[model samples]
Target: MNSMTRIPLTQLDAREPKSSGPQQARLPSAADVPRARDTQFKDTHGRRFSYLRLSITDVCNFRCNYCLPDGYQCSDKTEPLTLEEIRQLAKTFAAHGTRKIRITGGEPVLRQDLPEIIATLKQTPGIETVALTTNGYKINQHIDNWKAAGLDQLNVSIDSLDPQVFQTITGHNRLHEILTGLDRALELGLSRVKVNAVLLKGHNGDQLNRFLDWVKTTPITLRFIELMETGQNPDYFAKNHLSGESIKQQLLANGWQQKIRSKDAGPAQEFDHPDYQGSIGLIMPYSNDFCSSCNRLRISALGKLHLCLFGEQGYDLRHLMKENKQTELESAIRHLLQDKKASHFLHDGNTGAIQHFAQIGG
Candidate 1:
C-alpha cells in the first residue's frame, strides 16, 4: 500500500537468491528443490511450520535505549491490516496446520480491537492456542477482558526487576504495575504466562541472579533473549551484545536441566530445575544451529509473509487476500515456502533487512 516492492507469487521461483557471500552457503536452486505438499506448510529443508507471529501494528510507545531510543517515527503512511484482514489471514493459516497464533506489535495493546482479534483466533477451528506479547503498559486494565475473550498465553516484556534500572531501560517506571498484571494473568487461569527480557550488556547482563531469584518463587517462565543486531542498531549491538551461552553454562552449573522442545514450541531452549517453582528459557539466536528447529513463520503488520525474521525481503500476499481467494492465498503461501533458506546469516554479522524488531514483531 505504501508503494513498497511486492514480490508477486508468480516470480517466487524465478527470483535468484539474495546473496552468495562466504557466510551464505550455496543452497540448491528453487527448481532443484522439491515443493511441499498442498495440505501441510513444509519448506525445502523439511521444516514444517505450525506457529504464526502476526504483528497487528508497528506503532509503539516505549523508548528503550537498545530499540527505539529516539522513540517511534512513522516512515510509511500506510495503515495496518484491518481486523477483517487479520481474521481472514488467521483462518487461512489455521486451516493449514498452524496450531498456535501469537499476536505481537510495537505494543499490541495499542490496538483497540485486540480483544476481538483474540476471541476470533480462539473460535477458529484448527487453532489450539492464542497468545499475545505486549509491553504491559495497559495490561492491568485489560487482562480481565482478554482472559474472558479466550486468551490462552501472555508474554510480557519486563527487562529488569529493579525499579530504577527498569525505568532506565524501558524509559518507564511501571514495573510494579506490569508485575501486578502478570500475577493477575496467572490468577485468571491462563494456561501459560511468560516474561521476556532482552539481555543487554552493562544494563541487565549481570542481573541474572535477580531474575532467577524472582522466578524461583513465581510460577512462570522467565526468558532471557540475547540482544540481536538489527539494521538500525549496529553500534548499540557492538556495545551491549551479551551472549546467552554464558547464561546457559551458568544454569548448567547450577543444576538446571534442559527440557525437550515440543513440536510447536518457540525458539527458546527451555530448562527446568527441581528446586525452583518456575523455569528458565534462553533464546540465543547467534548460537550454532539455532534455526534448525524453526517451527514458526511471521506476517508483518502489512500482509507480507516473511519466511525468516532476518531474511532480505517479504513476499506480498495481500493481493490474493480477497473473498473466495483462499485457494489462491494458500497456493501463494506454499510456493513461497519453497524458497525459505536453511538458516539465517546472523553469525556472519548480517542482520538482513530488519531495521528494527518492531517491524516484524521480534
Candidate 2:
C-alpha cells in the first residue's frame, strides 16, 4: 500500500537460518538478560507461559457474521475493568514472567484512552512487547498517537479485499478504512503488521488469489486462520469449516514452500512464496495439534483468567482485585497458571463453555 520497494521472496533466502552460523557458546555479560531460572509461570505439563492476551473491553463496532450474529446484544450488567486495574494486573503479570502482551477488545480502538493504556503497558518492566488486535476502523485516527505511546505491533482483521464481500462478512462497509490503517501503519515503522483473516467456506474463501495479489502489493504478512467452533456460531462453523491444511495445500500448489521451523512461531505455520517477499501463515487450532508448546494465557475484559481459549471455566481475578487482596490475588494467579490444562478440547469439535468471542475480547 505504501510506495516502497517490495522485495521479491525469491531474492530472500526461504530457508535462511536465524544466525549466520553456529558460534562458540558465550557467557552472558549483562545482567539485563532474563534467565530461565527466573521464569515464573509454568504448568504441570512443563509448558512455560510468556504471553498474555489482555482484553481491554468486550464492546466491538462490527457485527461479523461468524464472531457475532446479526442483532446480537451484549449485556451491560458488569462494568469493564478500569485503567488502574489493568495497570496493576500488567505489573503482576510482568513480575511473574510475562514477556509479551497483546491488548485486544471487541475492537480495542473503540477505547478513547487506548493511547494511555498502551503507554502504561509499555512502562511495565519485563514486558518486552505491547501489541493490539483491532478491526482497523478507528486505528488510522490514532495510529500516530499509539505509536508515540510505545505500541510495538498490530494484528488487523481483514477477511477480504473486495469491498462488497468484506461488507457482507463484517456487516460494515469500511474496508477502505482498514486499508488506510494498514498503509499508515506500514509507513509508521510498525515492522510486524499482520493481516489476520479467518478462513470460512463460501465466504471470502474464493479470495485466496486476491489475497495473494494484495500481499504482493504490500509489505505485510497475511495470516489465514481456521474458523474455530465458537459456540455462538455453531451453525456457521459446521457449514463453513475450512481447514488450514487445505489453505496450505492451495498455497503450495501455487509455488509456496513451507518455511523452516527452527524458531517457535506460536500458532501459525508460516510459508514463503518464491515470487513474493511477504509470507503467508496458517493457524490450525482445530485441524492441527498446537497446544503441546502453548505458552500463553488469556484475560477477559472482566478480569477472568482463561488458561485455554476453549476453556469452559475461568478463575475470577476481578473479585480479588476488588477485594484489595493483593497477596491472595498473586497466589491465585500462580495457582491458575500451574493448574492450566495441557490442551484445549477443540480437537473434539467441541466449543466448550465459551461461544461468544466478543465476551472474551476476541
Candidate 3:
C-alpha cells in the first residue's frame, strides 16, 4: 500500500469506532426552511434525485487505461472522510429522500472496513439499497461477510474476458480472480450482480460474442459502457472510443432483441436474448445524453458533493461536517442540489474540467 493511501489509526478511531452507537449527534431540524414540494433531492427542472454514489477512497491498485492515465500519482495530501462521517452524510441524504446509495471507490474492497461500512449504511433508516461498484479484485475474500453486512447489489467491472486483453487494458493480470469472484457472488445468491465491461473500439471489441456466450450460462446482467472523455490521454480515447450505437447494432445482428422500455432508475439501456437467462445493458454516455432523467449525486472520497459527473464544481460537505451544523449542512446540500447543472458537457466539442474518473468516483 502507498503511504499516502494509509488512513491514520487515530482518525479511524475518531470515526466513532464500530462498537459504539451512532456517533453523529442527531441532525438539527430544517423546519425553518420550507421543504421543497416534490422530491427531496429534486431540482427546479423536476428531476428527482435519489441515487448517491459515494467514493470511499481515491487509491486504486490497478491503473485501468479508461479510468486513469499511465504513471498516475495518488495524492496522500488529504485524508478521506472516515466511515462515521459517511454514515452521517448518508443520513442527511436519506432524510432528504435519497433512498439508493452505491458505495464506490478506486476499488471499494481495498478499504479493509468496507463490510462494516456497508453494514452502517444499511442501518440507515431511509436507505433502501446499499450497492457497490468494485473492480472485483478483492471481493472474493469478503463476499460472504459483505452479504451478511447488508450489501444488496453489486456492479463489478470486467474489462475483458481474455486474460491478455484484460491485462493490456487494466495494466493488471487478475482476470481469473475477477471471474472467480463473480462466480462466488452469483453462487452466494446475490440477487443482482452486473458485470460492467468498458467497450474499447479495437481492443476487447472482438470479444462480444464470447461475452454473450458467457451470459447464456448465468443470470447476471452484463453492461457494456462506452469509453468517455475522463481526462486520460485524448489520443487514447479518440482511438478506442466505441459508440453504444455500434455495439447495439452488433448485438441485434447477433440475435439479441430490445426489451420493452420500463421505468429504470439508472441510465443503462436494456436489451435481452430470448434463449439466455440474463440481459445486456448499454451505457452510451457518449452517444446518448441521459441527463434529462439523471437522478444521481456523487460524493468524492474527500467529501465533496458533485451534482454532475462532468460539472466543474462541487460543494464541500466535509467542511460542514467539521462544523457539526446539521441545519447548515442540509441547507447547503439543498442549495447545491437546486444549482445542479442542467446537462453534462462531456459530449464532443464541449469540455469542462478534465477529471480522471478516479477523482470523481466512477
Candidate 4:
C-alpha cells in the first residue's frame, strides 16, 4: 500500500471472514485459549492491556463538526448495558489486572444514573482510577455528585478558547458555563483534569497560541487530538484534518519538555513547561508506531468489544455479561484478545465500521 492509496471499504469487507451466526463463533475453545502471562491481559503482539474505555451511551447534545456534525442520530435501537452489566464488566476487567477505567459517551452526563455508575466502578476491586469524559454540558450541575461518587479524573472537550470559535465549532454557546464548571471541578480537588481539543485545519488550527495562553495559568492538561479519517466524512476529514506534529514541534522549540509516558496511560504524548502551570498533550494517531503501546480496549454502549477503534469489526460481549456468566465472560474476553490486530489500518484509509466518533465514544 502506498501513502496516497486508500483501500476501499468494499474491498476491506471482502477480505474479512463473513460471519453468519453470533460473533461468539470466533472465540477459541477454552482448552485452546492461551492464558495471559502473570494473569494479566496480553495480546499476541506482546502488548499488555490494563486500561478500558467503557462507553455508557451514544447520545450527545453537541454537534461538533468533527464528530456528530449533524447532531446525534440514534441508529442502534439496542438498549445500553444496564448498571449491573457495567459493574460486572468492570469487575471482570479489574480482576484481570486492569487498573484504570475511563467512562465515556456521546455525553455520559446525559445518563441520570452516572454518579451511581462512577460509584460502582470506584468500589470495584483492583481498579485505581475512575475517569469521566464529557462535553461539559451539565458538569456545573452534577460535578458535586460526581466527585462525591469517587470520580478520580475528569476530561472535558473544549475545542477553542475563544467563545465565538467555540460556539462555531460545537454549535453551542456554553463555553462560559463549561469553563466555570471546570473551575468548580478543580476547586473540588479532582486528582486530574484535562481539556481535549480536536486539531482542525481551518477552524481552531490557528488558535494554538490562544489555547497555550489559557493553559499557562490554568492547572489542567490541554490535549490537541489529530483529526482522523472515519467511514463517514472523508471529504470533511480531507479538508480539516491537521497533524499534531506541527504543534509538537512548536512546543519543543519553546522549551516544553516531553514527559515520559506511563505504561497504562492513553496515547497522548504529554509535554510540560517550567513557566506554565498546566501542560500540553498531543494525540497523533496517524504517526509512526502510534499503536505500539496499546494498553486499552473499548466497549461500546451496546456492550460490543472493539479491539481497535479502526478495526474491521466489534465482537458482541453483551450476551456473556449475565450475572452467572462471569467465568464465561472472562474466558470470552481472553479468547478475543488473541484476535486483536497488531495495529489499526487507519493510515491505509480503513476506518472499519466506525462512521463517526459517537458510535464508539472516541
Q: In model 3, which regions exceed 4 Å deviation?
A: 1-33, 37-39, 322-324
Candidate 1: count the clashes.
0
State candidate 4's TM-score.
Answer: 0.93
Q: Please say which candidate is ahead in TM-score: 2 or 3.
A: 3
**Which residue pairs show backbone clashes in model 1?**
none
Computed on alpha carbons, the lDDT of every model, listed in order, comes to 0.84, 0.76, 0.76, 0.85
- Look at candidate 1 and tell me the lDDT of residue 200: 93
lDDT of 3 by residue, 148-182 (tens): 99999999999889899888888988889888888
Model 3 scores a TM of 0.87
Per-prediction TM-score to the true structure, in the order listed = 0.91, 0.86, 0.87, 0.93
How far in Å is the alpha carbon of 205 misplaced in model 3?
1.5
State which candidate has the highest TM-score. 4
Stretches of model 1 off by over 4 angstroms after superposition = 1-4, 8-38
Candidate 1 lDDT by residue in tens digits, 1-362: 12245644433331232422223222223354444455668888989889999999888999888889988889887788887788788888988899999999888999999999999889989999999999999898999999999899999999999999999998998999999999899999899999999999979998999999998999999999999998799999999999999999999999999999886566799999999999999999998878989999998888778888888557767656676777767767777787788888888877776778888789
**Model 3, C-alpha of 208: deviation from truth (Å):** 1.0
Cα RMSD (Å) per model? 4.9, 13.4, 8.0, 4.9
1 against 2, candidate with superior TM-score: 1
